[model samples]
Target: MIDGAAKSRKAQVHRMRRIFLFTLLSTFAISAQNKEKPTVQATPAPYEWPAEKDKKYQISSTFGESRIDHFHNGIDLPGEGSKVLAPKDGRVLYRINSEFTPGEMPYGGGNTLILDHGDGSNATWSGYMHLKTFADAVIKNAPIAKGEKLGTSGNTGHSGGPHLHFFIYHPGERAMLNPLLFLNDLYYRDTKPPEAKEWGVLLADKFANVNPDKPFRLSADYPVYIFLQDHGVGKERWGVFEYKVRLDEKEVISTKFDRIFFKEGAWSLATGHKFEDIFYRNLYALTPQVRRAKKVSVEAKDLKGNAFSKTFELKIQQN
Candidate 1:
């Protein structure tokens, strides 16, 4: 007769194998769902551009652009002494004045203004940063009209140069939304697709050293990184709006830069949510157990629907 203890141990091993296989299958199913297109829950009201009608301005930076420490929270219109206007009807909520002082650090967004539209449940706030000063008639708790002059752009308060930092805030969630969604197509034009500068796998603390033109061996699993940027009509380097990663032709991660929020404070620039957490929905971390494919690909797109894609071959390193 067979030993009872040995039979029991064998059964346990079988059960554990089944559990592991089920988990792996479930993970792939979830990843496939994340590849679906995202939908916006709340559509914002129409708003006019905040720049002067007759003059032209260049976009210095686009929303969701990655910076050295933090992602750019708003679009930048670079111009010296450019007129800043209210995009919609709202009430001036707050204003700041940080006069330039040599050898002294001023406020983060030197000379700022916030306007509140609607009330209670539907309230939304529009923010203007790096202003030279508030408009002469603008006052606290005063109503502002659509297309009204609000201020002039300047290089004040921790700014590199003169520009208008514009953004929209959803009060209900306390998150920053991409203002490009609410603006008209006539405001700006971009026809070129985003470019993928580099793509590689992260090994431990650093990227695997391999020539990109040749096939690289990946001994261990690691997260992937894609350096992408957009180009506008003027050939300005800007930020892309969306990106996706695929493994062996199966999509693993799909993300769009639509909104962002701070985790620690209400609006601390330095400490905010991780890039993957806010934008990605599946296979975000790329743990060792999840890296089983030999082919990897990445795609990036700009706000105007221009897209770019590239694929790379990955081989499992032999011991």
Candidate 2:
């Protein structure tokens, strides 16, 4: 009887040990599963128009447009003395008041206001530039409501005319995003396709202009360049949404200028190349072997989904 009772106690100890091991493994499995899952970012609230009671506001220039040296950083709404409203409810992160300085030109954005919408991990910021004047209540770190009048549009800094330069950015990444994605496009009317005006080849630092209707000969290696533009409802010309380059029916370079990515804490063009190397960000370099191709094609699309294509005949120049 004593031996039998001892055996029974040993069996109970074995069962307890097995249960403990199973529980430990189950907890670890649950923890691992949770760790492998990704955190989903909450959806952001829709943004309102920045202009007050305005339906005829036009986008003079668009984001990612090729400028003289650098890409245009924001969208331009051409108007004078128009009220600039807050796009969303947020707090003023900071403001640059360059209007008081005499004989000093406001280089980039003359007078600018930055607002932060702290939405936890999906926080975003908006920048209003070239303001004529700020409201009395718009102070640094002050809370602002959507549709509130922040300031008046003006030609305060580096602006050719009175306009509001609006841009949206990710606060954490400090990268500029397309504001058109947030704003409602139904308010405006635009259905024009992007136009491919000119195509040329850069050889030995000289542009060998090519007529798309005629075949051009190029013996040495050269990079192709495209001059394209888009128009909205009015005669306002903007930038194309995306573009592609093809040689001998093979796609070589394709780019979509939807978002201007950031690198080294500064904005970069969507060329996949260094900003300094490609100042225009509209040039497509070709390999030496591919330069001998007999055909080249260029295509572009606008923000409204309108598309355009142009083909050029090429010939290898005999040395």
Candidate 3:
């Protein structure tokens, strides 16, 4: 078995070329290489989950979710049959099967496929990666129907188990759109809201939890963080969809996670908020670090339109 360190390096070396080629095609636009003129979807969107809906499954991740350094570009769906299917009617633009390759699939995105669901200049590519094998029907530039099996899910890359990493890419927008925004037609829904537990202040480059009811000594303006938690249909924590912070009755920060922008080799939200600016030490979703404040309040919402809020009363603590 490959150890942790080896597993990482294995991915870097084996999948570098594959990733580059995939990015190249996706970057320019997968529709460019279509064998025939790309067709448009009859409906609004293929929005169907990338796997067998009737099969036992769970969404392990959400769109625009946070990662170590970059944000999650797509949703993670893990389920039975390993049946990877087409989210909508589209032409198979490309396919990759790492099993035929000699080394581990790098970038942890193994055995992938790209499908163009719209005509050129209006193309939206559905990404299905890390599959066990490609379905016979997933032919290059061949038309595929919604829910049609494209491949079997597999631990093709540096994966721990079998699951599917599905994503949506719009070439025109040059942004990663949130898959959940258009997937409300599904039988499953997430009504759970975000939970805000404790409030903390980031002072002197350190995070310290504090009770809103008690007095906290403060010298100057410092970043404040809130320990917030959110979940989907499952128990796994999902990031909030949007957030707004208020200080002394003035709106300080308002941001949403509807989409992610990749610019200058970095990930950011709307208004150019970096990962660190939005998340404090990767523990808090919003860091209200504006300035000296006597009152502060926070409001947040999850992807399902669930809302949550909390207000704090700060009494200046003297040293």
Candidate 4:
């Protein structure tokens, strides 16, 4: 006795239920596989700390924070005058004698060494700065192993005290990554959040200007990196923060960070591969102007109503 429209509606509802059941099963299967894998990967430790000493040290500073002029680019491993070891077996690519300084911080990857691991991954051009001296004849291109003697830690080149200024670099990215995650095999405790810092908008250009009239396009090749710091009630917080890139108050790009979890306290935006842009010549440019406004703005909001923003004022300078 049902009409044609009712029959169509019933069919549509059945189809939707089928889709919902399929999606639920797929999600459960993926979750089960993930749970079976090691919570930590089984990569070999890069080096051995001398005498089984404590790998525990307070982080003195971080990479990519707003520096006096440039950006700090690596995590500083607190040594407390402890000897620094290689994190993995790598061939010595290059070594720098000078240490890093806040005045010339980014350049102070002091006594640095690059290692080629033959695999797709490479060590973070391990830099042991503030050192008294190398472990004797540890020269460039020398074969080095994990736990092998590199050098004693010291306060050198822009260093505050005796500690190892550790820096890890991915193969081709201009940005450095968090080494603490890669070193999960080590005995360090990580109840703290990854340090959230370097609060600034990724502009459409090198000038830090975004066009409001035009839609701001983030390169999908190289991901836009954001330094996220906690500014809320501690563990009581359990919600996602939303980020949107807009021009002239019109929402262009929007998303929520429900999956980006915090551990040991810090969070980084590197995992969001959806926004990475790499191949374009204008890595970031405020364009596609619709003649509405001349400038554009970017806004970020945490679920708790905490927000940070940056506005790019347009310019017409000729090259």
Candidate 5:
């Protein structure tokens, strides 16, 4: 009887040990998974430029601003009044009819359609702003194919002549994502480095006591956008004045503009991977704590080596 009791105790201890080990492993696994899931949809899906060959257009402004007070909420594809197409396989969320009398600066974004991809991710919209009308088959809750015609481009909304203002949005957060990364043939890159428009100590936008002479270390959590204003038109050098972005004067990002063929006026632009909203938290290891009330300076230079500097102060906080 004593032997049996001892044996039973031993088995119970062994089972308990196994259970404890399993729970420990499970906890560790869950932690690893949490660290691995990306904040943004890094996975490239089947997305093509939403325009046909004869589509007369160019991409204008992009997501994230080099300036303050306004951040681009979406990618702007210059439609020069071309028929806009669906970005990918998705459902129409809504179609908004618009009026053009607002005197909005760049027109053609009127008569827009929103698309829901059902992935907690949706294109808040896609449409030929200032369009003549929807395609014959287009209707609310209708399915759209990639590159299918939705409407004929027209001069509507706030516009500069006839052009389509193509845009893409992260529906939930309403953040504008660079549509170029999602599109296959709709980008420009060149081997030559972009012209150096300027380089300076980047600071938080809201610095009331901005010290331009001081090399303020960028707040470790804040990512900086190097705004180049001198990107020229059709200069083969991406018409870009050129630029270099450095953290502590160490080159982290730099580029030369690749000049496009027709839209010499079209600007070539790019951003630092470390500076995106989705990755700002990850950048904490790289910068200083930029207080909300601070300003960063840029020492910009033109093609002729003419140098000018500007300071932009903005309102930022640790969210």
Candidate 6:
């Protein structure tokens, strides 16, 4: 039988492995005694939204979104057969046009294209997945221009629907960045901040919804979770960029999904914090640190940088 507690335990084990690997790699870099390895100083490259002039694609998903067992490594843009374009000037790494059966898909990324977007040791790669086919102008290893036609978005690979699963990766740094931050010409815009619809805590394997208006009694420490939601101009859902939790005016946890580094073959937020550490249920996650509630608070911000906050009082029971 499937259980949330069991799943959380498994994720906890995975998180421990991530920490161990990060520590091991930090001390064991292979380099000459006096010569330090060259590190890539990469930044967000200016990018046009990778779609045609009139195509209205909605931001269906965001990077580092909690995926039950993993973090979403990319953003999903859903539109009606939008023309996919090169985000910026880059050389083609390769393109694939796959023909698949009911259960078989090529590379699990159907009709995908990867573009090389960095120079020298700065090995950045951009991926356009679930494409129909590459444009005639796009050839393997050839340079492509910004706004140049790449292909049409489609339902390929392990996709459930027709959309573009776009991702940015710095292979040298082993990190996946939030692509929305680089798009200067995206179709959707959000001036609205994320909303704190409700508040609660996961105590002793049970989730208790808190009525902020009413004081609740708690004797022991418990994990807090908040229902934070974000929407675009057209009500399409999205993930936020940053958040913070506090207790009695003291900050307890802070997390941002701007970029996630690959550690020990798993995605981790900051140094630790696996998927379970940051998320519980859906859109309801706070800190793993069991906090004693006095004045519990939350500060949330959306991808467009709009911010919101909420606070509620909880009485601590004296033994």
Could you tell me which 10 consecutive residues in candidate 4 have the lowest summed lDDT?
277-286
Candidate 6: pairs in clash: 110-157
lDDT of 4 at 227: 39
What tens digits encode model 3's per-residue C-alpha lDDT throughout 116-233? 8886565678888778888887878899988888988876665556778777776655556777776644645677888877766777866677776777776666666676767766
> What TM-score does candidate 3 reach?
0.79
Instruction: Report backbone clashes per prediction.
Output: 0, 0, 2, 32, 39, 1
Model 5, residue 53: displacement in angstroms? 1.8
Better of 3 and 6 by lDDT: 6
CA lDDT scores, all candidates in order: 0.65, 0.68, 0.67, 0.42, 0.42, 0.69
Over 4 Å off, model 2: 1-43, 269-290, 316-318
- Model 6: weakest 10-residue lDDT segment is 28-37
lDDT of 5 by residue, 170-203 (tens): 4333234445546664343323332333223334
Those runs of model 3 whose alpha carbons end farther than 4 Å from true positions after fitting are 1-26, 30-46, 100-105, 199-213, 217-222, 288-291, 316-319
lDDT of 1 by residue, 1-319 (tens): 1126755554444344324323422342242233323332545687788888777667878887754324566799998788899999999877767664344432456787888876554566788877986788789899999989998988876566889988887655545678898876586789999886654466676554344456556666565555566898867888888767777878766667677643332232222336543222111223342246677677788898999887766655523
Q: Could you estimate the TM-score for every candidate?
A: 0.75, 0.79, 0.79, 0.44, 0.49, 0.78
Per-residue error at 317 for model 4, in Å? 32
Which candidate do you rate higher for TM-score, 2 or 5? 2
**Could you give candidate 2's per-residue lDDT for residues 148-264 as a string of tens digits?**
999999998666799999887664443467778778776565688887666567678666666656656766666656668788766767887777778889987677666665554
Candidates ranked by TM-score, best first?
A: 2, 3, 6, 1, 5, 4
Task: Tell me which of candidates 3 and 5 scores higher on TM-score.
Answer: 3
Q: How displaced is residue 261 in candidate 1, in Å?
A: 3.7
Which candidate leads the pack in lDDT?
Answer: 6
